[model samples]
Target: MSRTLFIIDVQNDFTEGGALGVEGGAAVAAGITEYLAEHGEAYDLVVASRDWHHADDDNGGHFATDAAPDFVTTWPKHCMAGTPGAEYHPALDTSRVDVHIRKGQGVPAYSIFEGTDDAGASIGEVLTQHGITDVDVVGIATDYCVRASALDALEHGQHVRVLRDLVAGVAPESSEAALAELGHAGAAIVESGALPTAGAGAPEDGDGEAGTAGDRA
Candidate 1:
């Protein structure tokens, strides 16, 4: 019944003031910090991920190289390694993180499974080594990295949950769609306040239906 927390891409580049800032990104960061402060000990491990792209290369076409950029496939240069954008948000308490993973080094990567730990271990390897059977994911851009990470966790045979209140997204419609997809893929969707004590009360099954937030669009 080991539970692990996956804090995905809470770096400066994805926060409210960064290169790819989301609307509620700053609030999500602060909310996660508050959640951790109250329930830090609930999980066996806390892993934080960052988009540590290279400055020279296009990172497997993840970054736009042409004059016109497609927001879907190509993004403005961001999270370059060793740059301020690659650093974790100042509001994030890194001291609580047990492992640090760097992704999209020189390629396109979204899921935490695509990254390696500080010790050069894959996310799957680390989880297996830790006997992590349950996972809770929270971070920036719910429609992308967070969604990818949660699906990968489920694929790895772990019971997965996404804390809705602790995440922000790039767009309301896409974010709600992503949540529906994750739910359909067997990941539980729950609010942070509704999460039960780890191993004591398990997450309820998701209905695989899209949330109401997308209606604003």
Candidate 2:
């Protein structure tokens, strides 16, 4: 089987010290780096998604401008296009990444596959061209971009797996919901340690129930 690894939004802006930091986000980068160091060669393809937004764009102004109503609670300006915040987290090992897919450049794109080049080919299309079949997803904010990308992968008929240990979330409740949604959508959820080898055929949380972290309010 052709296997691929999709590292989603492990950008500096989402890490612990960045503009819209998620708790434990830096740990996700460390964990994925360790995984890649050991098993990077097992995957046929390795791809990464980045949130590259322009500084003067609507996405940037949404938080600063008073004209628009505050949506999503008006997050701090982050991941602006071509800026350091928009780059991958420093701890990430990009040596294994075969393709770099830049998302959220034009609009507020959460899904990695949502962005398309002038030729109309999506990141998914690019992966398909490279013979990627099974995909393992990891990285920041499990409740948002990671979840959206995994769902999109499933919708495109690719077998998907979420590296549970290699992801952190902005909100505990939303993390639980994303996990449940991923399981419902037929995604296998496993820890990063089991990736690319031991847990390939393991059954997911087949109970089809959402689970919340105990500390979540």
Instruction: For candidate 2, write residues 1-217 as lDDT tens digits.
Output: 7878889999998998898888888888888899888778778888888888778856734444565445364555778888999989989989888888877664677888877644657877887797877888888778888989999999988888777878888888788888888877888776655444434453443322334432210
Residue 171 of model 2: what lDDT? Answer: 87
Q: lDDT tens string, model 1, 1-217?
A: 8889999998888987788988877777788898888778888999999999999999999999876668788899999999999998888888999999999989999999999988899999999999999898999779889988999999999988888888888899888888888877888777777665544555444532335333211
lDDT values of the candidates? 0.85, 0.77
RMSD of 1: 2.5
**Candidates in order: C-alpha RMSD to true structure:** 2.5, 3.6
Candidate 2 at 164: error in angstroms? 0.3
Q: Find the 10 residues in a row with the least total lDDT in model 2.
A: 208-217
